[model samples]
Target: MRNVMILLLGLALCFLAACGANESTQGNNGSGEVEGQDEAEPAQNDLDYPQKPISMIVPFSAGGGTDATARALAAASEPYLGESIGIVNTTGGGGAVGMSEGINSTPDGHTITMVTVELTTLPHLGLAQFTYEDFKPVAQINFDPNVIAVPADSPYETIEDLVKDAKDNPGAIRVSNSGTGSIWHIAAASVEQATGAEFSHVPFEGSAPAITAALGNNVEAVSASPPEILSYVESGDLRPLAVLAEERSDALPDTPTFAELGIDATIVGCPRGIMVPKDTPDEIVEFLEEAFMKGAQEAEFVEYMETNGLGLVVGNAEEFGEVLAESHNFFAELIPQMDLN
Candidate 1:
């Protein structure tokens, strides 16, 4: 009896040790990190979003207008966010690649996309891997109407003169745009449709390069945002033909709208905004919208935009969302009619 009792006690002690070991490792995911949270990542709720420095993805070249606006906004918004906002320039695939990376990121508000009008156009063109349905808009922060221009010393004097040149040349006029399916390209194409211009559509990576091409006389005309080509126009290196908007820009009041020029052209320009991945929690999206909009409205940010001739168009999340959907549907119908598609 004594020997059996002693053996039972030994077994009980071993079982207790096993239980202790299991308890110690209950939440471990191996590598000594807990399953739910780790030392580096403390437990967080929806309200506690952006525990780390946020990354804003600017899907364009660094020195472009988009990049400059993104940097300015980030600097302005950092105070409200209480964390640094880093800008990441992911350029390629006519902006589809960078937007893909932004939309597919960890579905956390930490990674935001500085989405542009391309967000709607790319999916319709079959260039993007994702669709607008994957978007969670923070806000629409900018709206720059398209401006088509030529070198200052070009033979074309007026908007009508440019159209006449196109009609006379029969696709000989090399017109440069930001990309094949870009907003600027659509502007150039719309001009072609309206006036039977038959322009030789040459696409570059971004507006800066497209404008550069026009500056070098590689292309006879270039279509880009007014803010982008403002310096060139002011410097007399380029001359504005027409703006693709209902009204003229404050900066370029002399630049006539397409309607004023008697061209029934499709208005195309980049309206940029902030968006997080679609799966990001609602509270986080709300928080981001409020913070970003407030940042966009900051005096310094507004001054920077106005100084650079960037049109500031701020809207709430819902409004921005409506704009995206409406623009998407418009392009859906419009893309079917275009020859480029």
Candidate 2:
């Protein structure tokens, strides 16, 4: 009898202990927090998007300005990305081959392409199969503004006077550009559109030759980058009348923007920005945009740009995307009339 009673008591105690354990396991403190359970995890992929070294594709030669600036930007962005950035020069077909490689790359944050004005131009010219819409813009780091200059001894002292003369003598004033359908050519076209003038566009092999033609009076005026014509202006060879940019060029502080002169020169020149494949996740895209925009403001990048006379204009993803969209639309409409088939 006593043994039976003991067994019954032991079983009862075991049941009680199990009940207590169940209650404890399901219990919560007064703070409403559960006991002995792990908290929910965070959204992890964004924090760890770039899990390896990043490849930056520059669609130009290694020793050129694009490659140099791209390398500088990559070096500046490394600290923010927590991964080293490698610059790869993929040159062919005037930026088509390299850009194609980049846009067709894996849609991860590891591959970044440094895009230029050619992104919009090449497509319209039938030079490239892909358009700006194929990629997501991260940020713009540079904008080489176009400057309109005449020979020092020319009668047109101001941009207004230059336009008036061109309007008076339609097709008489020859304007030189880098080449047909080039960004500088677009700049010259912008000049004619803004002022309602007709210019005889003489496309040279490149900006140097175009500027040389202006210097030697082969053309009445030239549209080119600020750096290309700075020495000539300093030497009193070319007289800068206006700049086709959102603001005046640092190299020619005295020259006014087309906007400042009541003309809207909407064409952009040699704007360099970072981009990823369009299929890249939005989270990764945002993360990269933050990194590159931060890097563009770094002291190293700014100093390098200033020393090299490269134009430094930084903007976030939204702004850069807007620029690409605007340029794309403008070129789409304008190229049909350019007769570049």
Best by lDDT: 1
Error of 1 at 71 (Å): 1.4
Q: What does candidate 2 score on TM?
A: 0.63
lDDT of 2 at 199: 90
Best by TM-score: 1
* lDDT (10s digit) by residue, model 2, range 231-301: 78889999999887655667788998887787865545677789999999888988888677667666666
In Å, residue 234's CA in model 1 sits off its true spot by 1.4
Regions of candidate 2 where Cα sits further than 4 Å from its true position:
1-53, 60-68, 89-94, 149-180, 193-222, 227-241, 245-247, 256-270, 306-311, 334-341
Q: Write the per-residue lDDT of candidate 1 for residues 210-323, one digit (tens) a residue.
A: 999999999999988888989998899999988877678766889998877778877666778899898999988887776776676566676788789887666678767876
* Model 2 Cα shift for residue 226 (angstroms): 2.4
Q: Write down the lDDT that model 2 would get.
A: 0.73
lDDT of all predictions, in order shown? 0.76, 0.73
TM-score of each: 0.84, 0.63
